[model samples]
Target: MSGALAVIGLGPGSPQTLTPEAAAALDRADALYGYGPYLDRVPAKSGQTRHASDNREEGSRAAAALRHAAQGAKVAMVSGGDPGVFAMAAAVCEQIDRGDAAWRSLDVSVVPGVTAMLAVAARVGAPLGHDFCAISLSDNLKPWGVVERRLDAAAGAGFVIALYNPISRARPWQLGKAFERLRQHLPASTPVVFGRAVGRPDEKIGIYSLDAVDPSAADMATLIIIGSPLTRVIERPGRSPLVYTPRFVEGGH
Candidate 1:
């Protein structure tokens, strides 16, 4: 009998943001596989076997989880944010497509949860209220030229861009370069939001103009939103500023 596998999203970093479906999936899992830090978010359950691996070992982790499920173990593959959004769901699907035939026969499901961009947008205002696209700055999988081209295209097309994997120790210069590319299309006064660790205790959110925004203020944990030309900011006397992109475009219905 083939067992089941669930690719689960843990939400941003707070238990409150975790969806009930994701929670139930976790409860049903007999074995869990994920990156070390992501695995640490789950409350320890007695008798549940936890398989932790490095963040860079997504393929190995997915394969291991599938192997266990093929042996009749109910497995859960965990990822921070929504599994389908640049997370483990794609990795798991890739493994099933290329791995052992038995892996294809096992039952597989993906449980969705809040992604980082959504959480960050909620903390301030709806920067994603208008048409938007997400792009990861990490060039590990794709060439850096591809990332730059996409950035230019997205900016020229007037879409609010949410940047993931903005910067890391190994990728210190990409975010700065991305900013330069965007500056070519967006105005100097375009709103830029730096939302770091949203839903976490040490969360920080800042708003700046594209010309004055500093790429060094960001890291891998940060989600950066570059507003479209139509995006706006409303200031209050003694409260945090509200930033949002209007839902309607002037010439569109």
Candidate 2:
């Protein structure tokens, strides 16, 4: 076992998209760590242990994995979607900042994975087709005041919003704050799409507006796509409803 903690992004749950380097790293891993369901995705390896936990325990879980690596274990800290995008990378860095010599002793590298924002954006014909910013509506690590500031900035700047952790069990009203901020910049007709359990069998994608979105409709599995000022709903003759950002279109009134 080598003294290294590898944070691997397991792409949007497809073996075909797994890069060769990630695959090889998994082969060398003595242990794997990540969200409970996501940890099940990796094929079982000989002598490898799997450490699984809920999403919000990222810091504690990651610190444990770092300890494993410190004690001469080749550990893989897994993140669904991308490791760096709304994933475990930040938690790992935070643990390192505490000056834990065990954390410092281990080599750490982030491996990229597919984020839900990119996946959902492509599914909706490019909601984030232009400059955009992402903000998680969860206040676990941040205060609502800070989240509100960012939400206001994104809306005022007309940047498409890739909202992560929009709503969860414990914190429901944070999303209301997010929508309230958006309303300051966008009109009631602005298109908003709610993508629940994306890329899975029971996946759902629905379009709504700032006023129309139901807060209870969102959960840990859901990812929301709020359109920019330039976004419009293109209802084609026979195709599915499309929510798109017309950022590149010229000569607008």
Separately for all candidates shown, the number of backbone clashes (residues 3 or more apart, or on different chains) is 0, 0
Q: Which residue runs of candidate 1 sit more than 4 Å off their true CA positions?
A: none
lDDT of each: 0.94, 0.83
Where is the poorest 10-residue window by lDDT in model 1? Answer: 195-204
In model 1, pairs of residues that clash are: none
Per-residue CA lDDT of candidate 2, range 1-253, in tens?
Answer: 5599889988766676667878888998889998898888889988888988987798899889888888898889988888898788888998998858657767899888778887777777878877788888877778888888888888888888889988766887777777877887898988888887666777788888877877778887778888887888888898878888876856655
- lDDT per residue as tens, model 1, 104-148: 889999999899999989988999999999999999889999999
Model 1 TM-score on a 0 to 1 scale: 0.99
RMSD of 2: 2.4
